[model samples]
Target: MLKHDYKVRTGNNQYEGFLVDLIKEVANMLNFQYDIYLVHDGKFGSKKADGNWNGMIGELISGNATLALGLLSITSQREEAVDFTKPFMIRYITVLMKVTKSTTSYFEFLNPLHPFVWFCTIGALLFVIIVLYVLERIGNINRTDYPSISFKECFWFVFGSLLHGSTDASPSTLSGRILTASWWFFALILILSYTANLTAFLSVKTINTPIKTVTDLASQTRIKYGTVKSSGTSGFLKNTDIEHFAKMWAQMSEIEPSSMVDTSEVGFKKVKEGNYAFIWDTTVNKYKTIEDCDLMEIGPPFDPQGLGISVPTGATYTEEFSMAILKLNDTGRISEMERKWWVHRNCPDYSNPSTDKTSGLQIENVAGVFFILVGGVAIAAVLCLGDYIAKRILKSVKKEKVHAISPEGDDI
Candidate 1:
């Protein structure tokens, strides 16, 4: 209908389409001859601000065409102007976008857990270290059997337990041991949860599209989105009372001519160039995606409608046409036509098979853990250096005091 060289037209000026085939079948059954031609404006029709119609709806109303075929969506507004047959195809408005390659993020390993979860984990680790230090100090006040645990050693023990690493420190008293056991169990559960989630997060190739739904497209500015101008999709957007659609229409109006395209083919080309999404009939979108593997449809239908033949208002043949279309549906001929047009394409399926299976965790998947480990080691090194310098200063002060008391630097 949009003048596709292969699907809609052949080199010899012959026409072909699922809707065309269905219309031919219906004509044969009804014993009527009809001529087919494209709408002069090449539009599905929309009520302009001046209250005039254009495209196929216009053609039908003005008696230029007996009936309009192609992907003419049934709508309440269009119904007011022209009569329509029972829908031959159920269609909905959906977003069409180019299938983008999955790119790696520097912090991709952190994706498994939310940032808040990571913050809480760090806070919990520090809290556990403080609790262990306090418990060990209290136990050491009465017991003389083992050396008292220092704050530094307590920190090291908790950090090592969380990482499932070896540590030099151990709890001597019963209270300290009990606390350590609880911390160890907690760490075990945390590790298991992180590992399981990381596996799934890494295996799935994340598609980072800002526009998943019509609402998403309306809400975002980074991705430019629109529909074919003077088409049913644009008409729906302009007329819808829904808040998001209303906002989107306003935005589209601000952009004017560029935001609205003349055809879905042009919209598809814009999508291929990136940062753009085309909102169009789901049936056409599906056919386009099948024909071009680089394209994909996003989200469920925004507006549920049906594709039907358009005829003049109160046309005498309306009942006969509707009944013929219903008969085609009853006999499964419509489904057969859909299979032939929509599914029987020669395009390659662009989905990656490796992405479907659970892949072994790569170093990048666990890179955050390694970064944390390196950071911990660095902090411990700094603390160790400070502690050594402080101890040395204290020892020097004591030696000087002894020397001053002994009246010389005499050995004890």
Candidate 2:
């Protein structure tokens, strides 16, 4: 109820907001004068230890006000003390948090895979390299065509093949070739998975948020969170039969300074200060996100309930007020009023973003990695040609010496 639906005090003690406008429209239709005021105790109303109601509900129960015009949630408990008109708005609880920018350092390119995944991949590569090297040595012992491979050459051969590049360390024996073929298959699959995943990381701007649902928040303790003290959210947590909400209540109860705050703005301020999340209505959270780019709604809305104009129980005018609201809705006046107050204003261009296409990875995005592969292939080819040339020169030199010698004397 502390959302923008509350009356905003202005000069001459007048008030404005969605609530103020709503009351005005109701008055014009019913042809009655209504004076707007805020509740003295500044509460949404909850049963205290002494067993008496307080806040706007108390104001109505004590005959201090006729109709509660703010965003009062209609509940069975509140209904016992006060009556509600047909709901003018529907809302639900949600989490609000500071917009933490994901890190964009040069090394962020490594984020496509988790640290554990990378560890396992490197371990597999190392294990395969040792197996291939041992197989080559075994082939040599059997007097096969396989040449003895040094650890340095093995490293280049494995890493270069993993990148889909040529290397001078090609195996000749059947066992060595089979082992190399298996590694090639593994490398192909790993490459395809990495490329498919990396496209999302490189193409779209994404927020690296770990908490995406109430279950996530309930499971974690590093981020402190709480609802407005005596709020419907607090009451819901206390009364909910769900286990996840129960755990959240226990955490909020033991938190330092009591995570329960007095107002939505105060709870929002905690979020702005960092490391704190405000549990409140999504309607209010959405409005705040629009005004401040640093704020965002983390999870989907839950516990849907209607926001209605509240009245004291057995009030004579209850039916009339409900009818007036119904008429306003039918005529689209309510929708018009919502757009008048809810549309984005003064928020910068980036605040209202369009659904732009997420482009795929361009050649320039990975040109450097391609160049590395090309350079390795070039060097390996050159070394292979040099070995072949050196062998041919040695063979020809021996032939020339033999031919130059006389047939009988064998002297050059």
Name the candidate that leads on TM-score.
2
lDDT of 1 by residue, 111-204 (tens): 7788999999999999988988888888889778787889999999999999899688888888889988999999999899988887768876
Colliding pairs, model 1: none
Cα lDDT tens digits, model 2, 1-412, are 2345335744314665677778888999999997676777678888788878989988888889897766578899898889999988898888888866544444445667899989999998899888888888877786644567877788889889998888887766678789889899999998888888887777875545656666788889889899888878888888898999888988997754468788877898899999898989877787777778777776667889999999888989999999999999999999998887767645322222342335566565566566767988999999999999999999999998889989896676
Q: Candidate 1: lDDT of 359?
A: 46
Where in model 2 is the C-alpha error above 4 Å? Answer: 1-14, 107-200, 255-257, 298-300, 343-412
Q: Provide the overall lDDT of each model, using Cα atoms, as 2-decimal numbers.
A: 0.81, 0.80
Task: Quickly count the clashes in candidate 2.
Answer: 0
**For every model shown, what is its TM-score relative to the native structure?**
0.59, 0.62
For candidate 2, report its TM-score.
0.62
Q: After superposition, how far is residue 342 of candidate 2 from its true place, in Å?
A: 3.9
State the TM-score for model 1. 0.59
